[model samples]
Target: MASTIRVGVVGCGFYAQNHLNSWHELRREGADLTAVCDVDPAKAEAAGGNFGVPHYTDAAKMLDAEKLDVVDIVTRHETHRPLAELAIGKGVAAIVQKPFATTWDDCVAIVDAADKAGIWLAVHENFRFQTPMRHVKRVIDSGAIGRPTWARINFRTGYDIYKTQPYFYNEERLAIADVGIHVIDLARFFLGEVAHISCETQRRNPKVRAEETATMMLRHESDAVSVVECTYGARKLPDPFPETLLEIEGETGAIVVGIGLRMSVTSNGQVSEESIGSPLRSWTSEPWHASQEGAFNACQHFLDCLKRGVPADTSGEDNLKTFALVDAAYKAAEEKRAVEPENWRRKA
Candidate 1:
């Protein structure tokens, strides 16, 4: 209670509502929902009214007004850089939404700013924080799957995502930037850092402006290989929308995460299988609950770290590695060859 971290959330839009809800749910764990901000007065007023927190149309004003310890940047990718800079500039810790920024350079700039300011900055990359994925990680750590040599992480669905966020149809970097980034992050989470990547992209949906399907091959630094794929073009019965199916093979055994959140592990020739589905919370719903819960879990982790004055698991510096993979994937697709992800820290 005494260690409660006063918090402010910016951008009360479609996806941001999840962050706001999550912060409220985290109050018991010492996250004080101090304020909320958005450019749209109606949206800000609506969220403020519902949450019983003061809302403002200006982020700077809210930051100046509230004695906040942390600020969650839930705005669009383009706004992430400046808003994060604003938070760090004020010496307040910041938690930014994923895709970190619109470009690799911007991502670097934000990380550098946080470093220079000596403030906590973390990216909200929550796919690996999903309940199933956490279970998978625990299995791997327990040595049931030894030295993971190969993995296949898949996210395919035809759910009407655009219906909820129509702006997706016009995004220049559609699928990979939107969802493939999550799958790619999962690849790193399951295996290790990528050594190089080869990818193929498709514009299966005639209506979308950019690629909606991305199939990738990753060579990890450990010489392990993985197939990472995501698409919004699949037309399957009982679509597992928002679920990521996985198959990981190691020296000792294998782990398979299939439809309906079912997971099976083979160790020492013994097979064990069960449902690893995410549970629904009062503020969560079907299909989307897994993702929403992940957001909450990620927020909780960040808050815990902030209170302890430590770097987050998805700290700004660490996420650059994941962002690099996304950048390299697009290049690999264009050239039809493998490309090593860019590392900004290499000595010149």
Candidate 2:
């Protein structure tokens, strides 16, 4: 293995440029950005010039031609599985964007492929890496909140997504896949594996086919219950509704994250509150772009694992649980009943 990891990024769409910028920064720090790939020649060429990397129209050819140690996938949600599988098969480590795949089976297949190939795999579930969320995790883990029994993760923004990406109107790529997955994963980070879920989904925007709002109840394996709410319908508030609000109530105390980044705790008959700053803004103002920074961190972590021999923070297998929660949430909404997490499965 070389001292500097050779990395390549696939996809140059709306969000791909952030990944390119992060990779260039990482390269300056220590890594090597060997090349970039995109189906659109224009995108590939633009990204290549912006990052000063070799360009290719085909990711497979880029992988075959460059001695890459890591392959970053920032393509469409649908392409994540195949691209990740290809990278694993080619003996390269992989860092994939959120909504790992459309279904549980694809997620399972990606995990299995990485496991069999003995390559590191990580999903870029960045919200949890945000400063406020990270502080919340620290408080919970430190037992300041005691043994958490209930929690809530709320993300609501009025920013018209369709105006930025009209494809968001596509029913096949609903709000659940686009934003709900991140909220689901954030809940899981604090509450652990979800055992059951009940959800209500609605398309508030008449012009769009996909759901604009979703509310889900999740029962975690730790016997903790959580409510997850996501909506593009949220009106911008005086105190802007947090892009995320996580409240965890444990046996000893309770902590609220992303609301002024505060954490409250009660222990031994004593109650206290602590102020913390936001961690989600290290990269960009756009939440999605900020998310890309988390993705870059995930990539660096994957590289570190490859170098030192360890497991990734968001391993492919672990992410299956996150996807399962998403699957259950959608099923619960469709059937108008509570759905068991384990009962969620990919269509054949």
Candidate 3:
């Protein structure tokens, strides 16, 4: 990988706008936006025109034509495996957007393919990279909260998400699979790996086809416990629509992220509080800036790893652990019992 990283983007849907803008903004930092591809010609053209790059409807054509160091696949879950496999075939690193894929087998296939090729593959799990979330992790790492023992993480909101993603209205695995995965991932981020997980789900929104609310509990390997909650049907005034409110307790003290991204930490007989909100950027807006900024940070991490010849924190292998929690949550809800997360092993 060179300091001047040549990059190609493979999806141009709703969320890909942020990816395009982030990559464009990173131009000063050495990310050369080489080309973009989408099956929809209009979308491909729009993205390419807007970003001033070549566009293609076929992914294979774009990959064959460009000398890209990385191909950022921002497509939906169902397309992740195939696009990843294609990129692996071309020997290009990929940053896949999460929900890793539609199923555990699909995610495993992508990871396995990348592993076999020895390619740098990562899932775009951006929540943990959010400014406020990073601040929380920083505090924890600084030992301000000592050894984390328990946590309650929630991403409850009634925002009209369907307006932007009407396709989600019919997803078979709505809450837990769609948005709860981020909250669940955050739980794993704050605590350690899960020993086992239990969950209860509900179809709170009559209009939705699947469960829109999920309440999960996890027992961490380190004896820490976490209660994780996610929903798209919460009714609240001035809703914390895109904010993740959490409370983490450790051996020495605790950390809490309340409404408005205000964080409070009580550490070793001392207390401090501040607003740990997302940083404003030219491409960011209210309510969505946290997520937008997180995408930028996640991309930066991937780019830096490519240049440094290292693996990402959210590498394909590591994210399998997070995706396993998702599978475990669904199983727990269905079986009405606590379920251990399924672990993956590389073929010898």
| Candidate 2: stretches off by over 4 Å | 239-242, 258-275, 279-283, 286-292, 343-348
lDDT (10s digit) by residue, model 2, range 1-348: 446878899998887776777666676556788899999999999989988889999999999999998898988778999999999989999988888887777888898899888888888777776656777787788887678899888887787667767888775747677889889988888888778899999888877787889999988879999999898877766333334766778887777665555666666567777776544434555445445655566556666666666777777777777888788888899999999877333321
1 or 2, which is superior by TM-score?
Answer: 1
lDDT by residue for model 3 (127-220), tens:
9999899999999999988999999999999999999999988899999988889988898888988889999999988899999999999999
- RMSD in order of candidates: 1.2, 2.9, 1.2
Residue-pair clashes per prediction, in order, are 0, 3, 0
Residue 171 CA displacement from its true place in model 1, Å = 0.5
lDDT of 3 at 244: 94
Report the C-alpha lDDT of model 1 over 1-348, residue by residue, as the tens digit: 248999999999999988999999999999999999999999999999989999999999999999999999999899999999999999999999988999999999999999998998999999999999999999999999799999999999999999998998899998899899999999999898888999999999999999999999999999999999899999997899989999999999999999999999999899999999998888999879999999989999998998888899999988998999999999999999999985744422
Which candidate number has the best lDDT? 1
Give the per-residue Cα lDDT of candidate 2 at 122.
Answer: 84
lDDT of each candidate versus the true structure: 0.93, 0.78, 0.92
